[model samples]
Target chain A: MDIRKLVGGNVARLRKKTGLKQEPFSEAAGISQSYLSQIENGHVNLTLLGVNDLAQALGVPPIELFRELSEMNPD
Target chain B: MDIRKLVGGNVARLRKKTGLKQEPFSEAAGISQSYLSQIENGHVNLTLLGVNDLAQALGVPPIELFRELSEMNPD
Candidate 1:
């Protein structure tokens, strides 16, 4: 449905949880702050590599980013 | 860098490989054709749900979708 919003929300949540600002987070994830902002705003499409970078920067599995989906579905 | 193009290329490749039209594939993936089109065109920001749906519809693991990245990197 609202995939952009969903992804943006997830990215924001993860960033906040990591206690990092946009600049540092982007640097850690090897992405530009503008691009990270676009992702957080759901304005840009993401590749698996970008997702992997974010997951690695967060020290978590990529699946963990989507874990909330199961909570909403519960089926 | 070009995440949208990469994702769109992957989706298009997978869809063509399946010998299915956009409608049937969308239906099987439980998504709207417009939405799938957006994804294929790199115009939509996809969530893990959408990715998983496409993966299931294509009869492949999600990781398989990103396997190409390894080949591109090779390091």
Candidate 2:
């Protein structure tokens, strides 16, 4: 299901929807801008802690980050 | 909010509920049993991809792992 890409794309989409820049958002999320950029680019694996931090920073539930995941087949 | 513990506890609970042991479940999830054990103990950080893989192995949606997350205050 390309979970990394799904999460990365959603993170970017939601961050943009909130009108937040990577620098400030990453600061609020307790991560560096470069790391957040890597996450947004699907070039990094985000820890569960990272997911919660980013979700909070984006003013959304962690589940919201997986909004596009229903199309996947777990098998 | 202790996200690591939250996810770890839930993962263990769901795994037990499914009647699968760590060895088989870890194999199905494509992770090492030791790594899964660490995750189950809340001693490891799980990436988004890891979360998805575990959720799929557990036969649930990724969000299900965060079922108890509503009590947290993002702020």
lDDT (CA) per prediction:
0.70, 0.82
**In terms of TM-score, how similar is model 1 to the real structure?**
0.50
Name the runs in model 2 displaced over 4 angstroms. Answer: A30-32, A69-75, B27-35, B69-75
Q: Which stretches of candidate 1 lie over 4 Å from their true place?
A: A1-75, B69-75
lDDT (Cα, tens digit) per residue for candidate 2, span A15-38: 999888999988878889999998
In order of listing, the candidates' clash counts read: 0, 0
Candidate 1 CAPRI grade: incorrect
Candidate 1: tens digits of C-alpha lDDT, residues A1-75:
344545566787789888999999988888899988988887755555557677678886554544445565587
Worst 10 residues of 2 chain A by lDDT: A66-75
- Residue A22 of model 2, lDDT score: 95
How would you encode candidate 2's per-residue C-alpha lDDT over B1-75 as one tens digit per residue? Answer: 477888888899899999999999899888899989999888878887778888999998777777664444354
- Please list all clashing residue pairs in model 1, or write none if there are none: none
Number of the predicted model whose lDDT against the real structure is largest: 2
